[model samples]
Target: MPGSLEPLDLGVQIPYHFRCPISLELMRDPVTVSTGQTYDRPSIESWVATGNTTCPVTRAPLSDFTLIPNHTLRRLIQDWCVANRSFGVERIPTPKQPADPTHIRHLLTQSASNSNPYPTRLSALRRLRGLARDLDKNRSTISSQNSREILVQLVFADTGSESSELTHEALALLVLFPLPESDCAAVASNPDRVAYLAQLVQHSSMEVRVNSAALIENVLAGSRTAELRAEISNVDEIHQGVVSILRNPIAYPRALKIGIKALFALCLVKQTRNKAVSAGAPETLINTLADFEKCDSERALATIELLCRVPDGCTAFAAHALTVPLLVKTILKISDRATEYAAGALLSLCSASEKSQNDAVAAGVLTQLLLLVQSDCTDRAKRKAQLLLKLLRDSWPEDSVGNSDDFVCSELVVPF
Candidate 1:
């Protein structure tokens, strides 16, 4: 009943031709196939995309796949909607035609053409970006036209008088396109391109910086070889830029997630792990964890787990005043993945530092660890919880643990 199109109760008679044959809804962006019958663009595109070759209304075998826009019908629909405004009908907007490959190729050429004036080239770039953003078909068309290579050249090779402005525009478009792993690998393998990327991440503009961070995350995730990942991770400029992105109070949430994921990938390398720890990754994550939701909390906590592997990372975790309480508070509170990461981070800290163990105890980690052991957390998390329970109990005198019988009895039976 909810999806029914019978408007008889609304006191307005609707024309039969205004409705799509497939969906029985008012046709928006009507288009006709070779069979001379019209359908809504989305409905017909979906029908064709599913491998149906015949017209839905006429049921005739289709010869041409071209969908000609039925402008007359669309105009009539708009006029009818305007006249029926009191009946709650709204006018549908005119749809732009999808940019074909030939047009996309022309725009690509104009954007990269040296003979064109700076404004003309930039205008072409902006137009192409608009097309890319308009539809998935346009994005695929632009990508198929070798847009990535041109954009890469703009960001890395061009040093023209307006290179910076052009580079930012190209970078924005590049981020929109789905970059292949092979292309990303090729870019990451070059030291000069990597250096340029480092500078771009630290760009004066927030949009540029956010785009650069996203691009780096993509490249880091796609880099096939350890050597390539290490090559990018070891750069002080690159890792520091990523850390600074996390530090920015006004950085977009997407940018923060990208920065955290990128830092996590970089931390896969031993040297980069040290660099991230030194850059205050633990402290920054601790400060931000309060505001993060389940998934982001899991990611931030996981990075903190990776950081706690080294002695200095453990020290950094302890040095942050909120670190122990945050880790203790996170256990059994967020998702199970988050619980595991937080437990793992706390175990690392408690195992390394007596002061951290005492701090964890003071923060009431015993109650959290006891709850973790009883809950249905992961086996790995349970093991860490058990270890933390034993570690905390062993670190304190029997008299200091208080009269909490459940906390003391947790160590007697393994949750396993």
Candidate 2:
């Protein structure tokens, strides 16, 4: 609510009427509520947003939440700023009014109409996206009017014969706000809708593709029924698309993270894990995990652990040239969860082959394991580290390995 105008000289006092009572700053966009009190639009909007039911100044109960723009007061403030230009008070640019609920309703209606031309519907959708991005009030209005359902319906209405632009725009709006679980369930429960989204993950438009990948993740995370989850997990296109996103160099980090989450969700089914392995998910994840700053290391590692539960996942990881070094580097660098997953993946590789064990040792896994065993990571991670130390020690001559102190405890090490 503090005005964005430049500060005025101490000698030049701002008129009391020109200031918002709540912020005590000059009013850039003065608005009067039903209680007859004028305040900055942002300040009063913030107050009402916090569930305040009364006027700040008069303390009167507010039955109406209407904020009437005070044009006269705004004009007066502009004139005052103009008169005091020498005092460093710059004229405030006119502020755009927040979208009215009625206008939002009209746009929603227009955007959802199949009778309207595609161009017309796209225009309405663009405006709605602008409103949702611009202000909290606009989003609330749209959300209250069942925008989620309308957008889902619009996307489902697509028959592949229509322009893809409309479907993409609808998807963009659907992801702009976080849809609750119930809304996600609505999309996930419908086979046609889920199939449409899976297909969209590979769309030519990068924006549309990434949005679809993220929406799939949301649907997976929000699926309440096991049947719905199993249905989504079985989509072969989704698995391939997620792997493609992880491998795509042009894709942004957020998109890659979405793809990773989607992969994690899909691989939850034991049978689907092999499908991901066959789709080269481990190689894509290894590449992603190689760059720590660019992508989510913990999730990428967690998904790797999940993938390694099967023999094919371990074989894929063991064959990768960068697997050992990547896992060795990631240990104890990120969160405790990341350390656990990294250790878990390395252990999976070791359990799979003797060559992988030699690779881990050559890549300096012993030092990392020693440090990991001594450090304050999770108990689960430390137990894995201790088991690794024992495995390495037991595999080779005792004298060739490091001190026995690294073996702080003994625990069974299982492959992820």
- The parts of candidate 1 lying over 4 Å away from their true place are 1-30, 50-52, 56-59, 70-97, 159-163, 251-254, 373-379, 395-416
For residues 1-416, could you state the per-residue lDDT of candidate 2 as single tens digits? 23334454347778889988998888888999998999999899899889999999999999799999999999999988888777777788777778988999999999988899889999999999999888777888899999998997787785454337888898888876676778777877787777787788877777777888888877877777777777778888888887888776555756676777778878877777888898889888887776544337788898898888799998998889998888888898877899999899888888788998888888888888877766778879987887777677756546755565535542323223
RMSD to native, candidate 1: 4.4
Report clash pairs, candidate 2: none
> What are the C-alpha RMSDs, in order, of all predicted structures?
4.4, 5.0
Give the TM-scores of the predictions, in the order they appear: 0.81, 0.81
- Model 2 local distance difference test score: 0.81
